[model samples]
Target: MTGPLITDWSAVSPYGIGRAAFEEGFRSGRTTSVPLENEDWLVGERADTEACLVPGFVIKEVLGKKGTRAMDRVTGLVVTTVGRLLDTTGGPLPSEDPDEDTALVLGTTHGSHKSMVDITRDTLTDEKPYYINTAHIPNAIGNASAGMCAIWYGLKGPNATIAAGRNSGIATLNYGRRLLATGRARTVLCGAAEEYTTDRSWLEWHTRGADETGTVLGEGCAMVQLRAPAADGRGDDDALAEVLGVSSGITGPDGVAAGLETVVGNALRRAGIGREEVWAVSASAPAGEAGRQELKALDALFGDLDPLTLGRPGQIGDTGAATSAFQVVATLTAAQDSARAAGRVAVLTSVDRDGALGCALLRMR
Candidate 1:
C-alpha cells in the first residue's frame, strides 16, 4: 500500500520550544543548563548527576483547572502537546464520517518515572503502596501515554507507544510510516515525550555510570500528523514533507564513522538524492565522546556538506527516548521555516546503542 505523507507537525519543548523562547536560546547560543547543586542524587548510583531542564513550562494550559496531580508531568506533556498539535493543524480528527481514518503513536524512554520513583520510594519506606502509583496507574499502562492521545482525539486503529532508549521517537516514525503504507491507518499522529525530573536521580546515576560530569536531564513532547495520498485531488491538502525514504543501522567494525557511512549511503540511495544535496543536518547526540562520534560520522557521510548541531544534548541533558525523535522534528520545523526562498534538503540522523543508527531524508514541498 502507498504510505502517507507527514502533513503537519508541531512541537512543545522545555525551553519554550518551537516558540519565541526556543528561538532565542537557539540564536543566542546560550545554554539552558544549570549546575546540579541542590539535586538529591543519593539514589543516583551510576548516572551523570547534573541536569538541564526547561526553565518554564506552560503546562498549565492543558491542566488549567484540573491540575497535573492525576498523572506524571511527562504524561501531561504527551497529551498537552498532541492536543496543541491538533489545535494547530486543524486535521480531520472527529469528522462527520466515523470511518475517517487517523492513527496515534507516542515514543518515550521514561514515561512514568515521576510516579515510578515515587512508588519506589514508598515501597522502600512502607509496607503500603504509594499514592503516586495509584495516580499514575490509569495512565501507567505501557501504552498509557498513547492511550491518552487516542482517547482525547478519538483516534482509532494502530495506537502504539515506542521505547528504544534515545532512539524511540525516530523508531516510532519508521513503524508509523509502515502503518500508513499498509493501509492500517490514513492520517497518523506520531510523537515522542520524556520526563526526567529530580526524583528519578537513580536512573541518572545508573545512566551516568562512574562519571559525574556532563549529565543534564531534559523533558519535552512532540506530535505529528501524517496524511495519505490524494484521492481525486481532495486530501493531499497539507503535505508538509514527503517521507522520501527511511534507513537505519549502526557502524561497522572500523568505527562509528564507518557505520554512519553505510547508513547514510543506503538512505541516500533510497531517496535518490546525492550526498552534496543535503542542506542541513540535525544531530541526535549528547555530550562527550558520544557526540564527537556522531560528528565524526557526519564528517564521513558528507564531509564537505554544511552540517549543524542543535547544540549538545548533554548541555540540555538527555530527555530519555524523546531526544532523537524531537531532533528529527526540530530539523523539519527549521527546514520548513527556512524554505520560503531557498532550495535546501535536510537530513535528520540519530545514533543509539553500540551502533544502532537512524536517518531520514526530508525535503520542502
Candidate 2:
C-alpha cells in the first residue's frame, strides 16, 4: 500500500527560526555552531563552550507571557515549531479550533533533562524535601513536551511522544504512518525536538568521555504534516513526498555496518523499489566510531549508485532526537530544488549509541 503523504512542514533550527531560514542556511552550506555565550547552559568548567542554538528563542518572548511561566526550552521549541507549521497550511491557529481528526507525535531523547535535574536538586537542597517548585513538576516528565503541544494547539486526537535517541524521528514517522493506516486519525503532526542544557551537556560530555573533538550539542524542532492517502489519488499534487517504508533493528557495537545494511535493504524491499532507483541519501553522521561504521555501510550499499549524499550534522551539530527529522526536511528541500530528484527515492539512515538503527525511504513528489 502507498504510505501517508507529507503535505506541509516547518522548523525552528539553529540557522534561525522557520522553514525559510533552515532552507537558506542549508543551501548556503554554512555551519550554525557558535561560541556558547549563554552561561546558564554551561555545566562545569570543562564543558564544551560551543553549540548550535536557535537565536532569540526565549520562551516567554516567543510564545507570549501567558501560560509560559514554567515552560521549558524543549517545550517552547516544539510549540513554536508546530505553530509555524500550522501557519504555513493557512489552517486554524490556537485561537481557532483545529480539526478533531488531527493528531500529534513528537520524538525526543527525554522531555527536558534540565527540568528533571533541577526539580531533583530543589527537592534535596530546599528547606524541606517537599518544598520543590510545583510548577516544574509537569515539565520534568518524559512526555511533557508532546503533551504541551497538544494542549497548546488544541489538538485533541491521539497524542504520543517517542524516545529513541537519534533514531526517534524515523520511529515517529513510522508510528504516524501506522496511525493513518489504522484510521486512527486523518492528519498527524510528526516531528522531534531536542534542547541544549547544562545537564544535557554534562551528560553528553560524560557519555563521550575524552574524545578530542567533543560533540557540539544543538537545540531545535522539525515537524511535518502527514495526511492519509486520498481516495481519488489526487493528493500527490500537493504532497512534498510519500512515505514509502521504514525499517529498524538493533545490534552490538561491532555490528553497526551490517545492522544498517540489513535495515536499509529491508526498507527498500518493503517499498518495492530497487536500490538503484534511489536519487539521494541522508545520513545521521554521528561522531566517533559509530559514525565511521554508518558511513561504511552507506558506501557499501550505494557507492556505485552515485546518488546525492546529504549530511546535516556537519552544519547543525548533533541535534540528538531531532536529527532524523531534520534529515527528512533537508531531503525535501534538496528534492524541491533539483529536477532530477523528483519522482525518485531518497533514503535516510540513523544509528544510536544504544544499539538502535533505522532506515526510511521516501518517494519524492
Model 2 misplaced stretches (Cα beyond 4 Å): 38-46, 88-98, 209-212
lDDT per residue, candidate 2, 1-365, as tens digits? 66899998999999888999999988888888888765453555536688888987888778888888888999999989998998832222363665689899999998899999999999899999999989999999999988887777778889999999999999999999999989999999999999988788887887783442667888899999998778878646889999999999997555999989999999988788998789998999888777888889999999899999987543888999999999999999999888888889999999887789999899999
Q: Candidate 1's residue-wise lDDT over 153-188, tens digit each?
A: 566678888776666777777878888778888777
Write down the lDDT of every candidate, Cα atoms only: 0.64, 0.87
Off by over 4 Å in 1: 1-3, 17-28, 34-50, 58-61, 88-100, 128-133, 209-212, 231-237, 307-316, 336-344, 353-355
Q: Estimate each model's TM-score.
A: 0.81, 0.95
Supply candidate 2's per-residue lDDT for 139. Answer: 94
Give the lowest summed-lDDT range of ten residues in model 2: 88-97
